[model samples]
Target: YRTKIVARSQNNKMHTIISWSIPLGNNILLSYIFAYGLGNHINITSILLPTIGILFIALGNYMPKTQRNRLVGIRIPTALNNDINWFKTQRIGGLMFVVGGFMMIGGGFLGMISEFWTIALMILPLVLITVVPIIYSIRSSHKA
Candidate 1:
């Protein structure tokens, strides 16, 4: 399914880049998971949380390079309107992703406590990472 999305991509370069991102991201995520031999005695939540985190880090790293485009990055209209907003949003997003990745690694440790807390640690950081940038872009645009 993901391959089809990448193969059928339209003229938008960012769209194409972001489209290919998923499969490439997944490869990285899987590589990290297996690199640890977690598969030998896998705790499902422990493995899953870190996998998502690694991918978030990769995507966030890529965000700043996306430029303003309908098909990628934070596509909110106000953000797309200015390069400052776009880059600022991406920078913050990248930082959040890196932080979120660490949080997920910590969450993997928490998996021994309970799956709920493990999932929460991973997901909350990601949610905050995504939402804060959007809000920042919108508010900054209003100020301008």
Candidate 2:
């Protein structure tokens, strides 16, 4: 399988792999190793790392650019019918996703709020982002 390392940021100091193979076993093994390394020092952040890693792996495989319209990707009907609308909606949605992710991640770090509340905050923005584009696409389509 093909593989490549991508650096997200200089400060982050972590590299993500773009891989064609399913590395579920490898991931589990790595998680175990990390957990063991942090034995007796386990904390919320340690737990969050694996959760975020899983999310990143899943998202990498199911990104909008890769799965345009099956079921998981954006599915605004009007946007699907019009390339320009599709591009615009996806770009906007992508930005919303990044922002929501950051908020959720920050909330995790803060550890003051309940996990459910943090998740809700992330979800609400995503839902709004999705709705806005769909509404705009429909309105624009009607005008055309």
Specify the highest-lDDT model's number: 1
For residues 1-144, what per-residue lDDT tens digits would candidate 2 score against the true structure? Answer: 111212123212112233422475466557767877878444444345335434543443333342234233356687768766665666556555555555555645544446565566556645755676677667777877
For each candidate, the alpha-carbon lDDT, in order, equals 0.73, 0.51
In the predicted model 2, the residue pairs found to clash are none
lDDT of 1 at 40: 57
TM-score winner: 1
lDDT (0-100) at residue 54 of candidate 1? 73
Model 2 regions lying over 4 Å from their true place: 1-73, 112-117
Q: Give lDDT: candidate 1, residue 131.
A: 92
TM for every model, in the order presented, reads: 0.69, 0.50
Error of 1 at 28 (Å): 10
Model 2 sits at a Cα RMSD from the real structure of 8.5
